[model samples]
Target: MTKIAVLGAGSWGTALANTAAENGHDVRLWTHNLNQVEEINQQHTNSKYLPHATLVDTLVATNDMFLAIENVEIVLSVVPTKAVREVAKKLATALEEQAHTVILAHATKGLEQGSYKRISEMIAEEVPEAYRSALVVISGPSHAEDVIKHDLTAVSIGSSDESAAKLLQKALSNETFRAYTNHDLLGSELFAALKNIVAIASGALIGLGYGVNAQAALLTRSLVEMRDLGAAMGAKPETLYELAGIGDLIVTGMSPNSRNYRAGLGLGKGKSLQQVTEEMGMVIEGVNTTKAVYDFSKMYHVDMPITSAVYQVLYENKPLRTAVADLMARPLKSED
Candidate 1:
């Protein structure tokens, strides 16, 4: 059995920790919340996050970063995008001597704000040389809600190091869960991050009472937007055609389980961005990602109309219907 360290006790992090523990790994989850650590260790349930699911008894919890990473073979992080560098820095400090022996992987999906770097890149910058293994990105269509239910799920493990990716596959996969390796780290990470923006669009469309036809149109057009932005950012074209891209977009964009989608739902109902953020009680990653990608696209000279629309609605205070009208009113273009 492998020893795994999971940073962050949020929904996604706890679900993944549960999966690892269920797979017979010695899993230790670290969080800043002392109350949550107590709950996970004593009650075997993260009531706030995964109230419906019972975590395995073997899964442990800690508030101490040192204890979490001690002697672990792999460190898997599912923290929010904003916390990637902070968490990676903490891990580097805590890993000390063990850094060279452990594999570092993150399921966090979002780009950094100023640099617009993928989660893997941010982690690499902060944790460089501290980890001997290439940072691996574990992402795709899976949701923490369904994952805790042991419903069938599949995800892509993207790493430049093939062996590190396979090791993560062995450590995490089971009968109900599977991880496929994709060497296209950029593509896997890109689609995973950008799809949340489209998901927000998806939720907003539904909340605004748009029917399936609108949903269909949004998905198709956003896929084009995602691919175009990815190409300008150096992603492999084939990777965007795979599970990490198309598959992930379908699930997140359509599901109520997505926090980004839920946030958009509130926005579509004419709620203020601040109001929706307060109500959700979780980080809506797409909010920040939309801003980052909007800037990134301008830098790359890519025309990202859908992203721009979402950005306008969220940041510029553009009315939802007005943004929709703007998109529809754009000059006609050939679908090449």
Candidate 2:
């Protein structure tokens, strides 16, 4: 069995660790909270995140970063986007001190706020050169709640290194879960980050009592927006049509399990962003991603009307209906 270290104790992190353990790997899940570590080790549950689910018996938990990274063959970082740099820096330091090498993979999705770097890029910047060559991105439509239920799920692992991608695919795939490999790291990462923005827009439509026609229109247009932006950012156009792109968009945009969608639902119902965040008690990635993508669109000169609408509603205090009207009122253009 492989030894894997999963950094982060959030819902996604715990779910991934459980999956690895179920695959017969020796898994160590790290969290900042000692209480959570105890809970995972003793009770085999992370009550705060996955309250109703029981973790695998083989899964262990630790608060010590060094202990978690010391001898692992692979490190899967599932922390929120904002925490990526900090956790990666710590992992780099631990790896340096131990003089060990392992494959680096991340399931975290979102761009850095100020720099707009993808999560994988942030890790490559922080980690040493030895580990950078094996970096992989594990992302797709799978949600933590459904994953723990052993529901059928498929996700993509993107890496420049074919062997690294296949290794991760082998480590994670099972009867109920499947993994596919792709070489378009940039496209996969960008799609994963940008899809959250579209999900927020989709949720806003539902919360505003819009009909299915409106939801369908928003999703179709948002897919185009995502494809255009990704292409401008050096990603393959076809990647936007893959699972990491359109597939993720459908699940996050339509499913109630998406935190970003839930946040948008609150906003659509007239609640403030702060209220939605407080009520959900989780990071609404799309809220921050909307801000980032808005800035990126301006910087890249990409036309993203839906992302702009979501950003206006969230940050500019533009009324929801007004934003929708603005989107619909844009000058007529070809659908190409």
Candidate 3:
């Protein structure tokens, strides 16, 4: 059995850890919360994050960061975007003297707030070559709640190192869980980050009482935006349309299970950003990614109107309906 260390205990992290454990892997699910360590060990449930979901008995949880990674074959980084650097730095210290390189697979999706760097870039900055053989991104439409239930889930795993992706693919795939290996690492990561913005826009439109037609339009147009931006940023064309891009976008935007979509819904229903966040009690990737993508668009001259609208609604206090109006009134261009 492969030894797997999951560096986070949130819903997604816990769910993934459970999957590896059920597959008979030696898995260590780590969380900074000591109380969480006790809960997962004694109760096999993470009520704080996945109240309705039950974890496997073998999926052990830990509070000690170093212990989790000791002699593990795979390290899954599932923490939020803000914690990526801190976690990597700590892991680097832990793996400093390690002779063997561990595969670093990140499921966290979003860009750094100011620099707009992706999670892999952040991990590379802190976790040097001696620690990790490669950085793999495991991302797609899979939701934590559904995954824990063993509902059919398909995800794309991409890495600069193809062998690492294949290794992780075999480690993660099962009857209910399917993983496809991808070579377009940049495209996979770019769409994974940008799609959250579209989800916010989708949720906002729905919250504003718009119908399915509007959602169809938003999905289509926002895809164009995602594609154009990804293209300019060196993403592969097909990757933007594959499971990592459109697949994830559809699920996150359509499902109420998505925190980013729910956040947009709250804003659309006239709740302030603070109120929405306080109500959700979790980090909404779209909210943070919105600001980063908005800034990156300007700096790179990528035209992203919907993302700008989301930024305005979330940060500038622009009315949801007003933002929608502005989008509808934008000068029409060729669909090419």
The reply for model 3, stretches above 4 Å from the true place, is 97-100
Candidate 3 residues 60-136, lDDT tens each? 89988788989998999999999999998888888885555799999998988888899999999998887788889
TM-score of 1: 0.97
Clashes of each: 0, 0, 0
Which residue runs does candidate 1 get wrong by more than 4 Å? 97-100
Cα RMSDs, all models: 1.2, 1.0, 1.1
lDDT of each: 0.89, 0.89, 0.90
| Tens-digit per-residue lDDT, 1-336, candidate 1 | 888999999999999999989999899999999999999989899999887788899999999988899888889988998888988888888866554557888899898877888888788788867464677888889999999999999999998899989988998899999999989888899899899999999999988889789988999999888888889988999888788999999999999999998988998898999999999999998998999999988999998999999999988889999998888999998986
Q: Estimate each model's TM-score.
A: 0.97, 0.98, 0.98
Q: How many collisions between residues are there in candidate 2? A: 0
Candidate 3 accuracy as lDDT? 0.90
TM-score of 3: 0.98
lDDT of 2 by residue, 1-336 (tens): 888899999999999889989999889999999999999999999988887999998899999999998788889999999999999999999998898899999998899988888988899899988755498998899999999999999999999999989988988999999999999999999989888988888888888999779888988998888888887889988778878988898899889899888888888899998898999998888888889999989999998889988888888999998999889999998899
lDDT of candidate 3 at residue 66, scale 0 to 100: 80
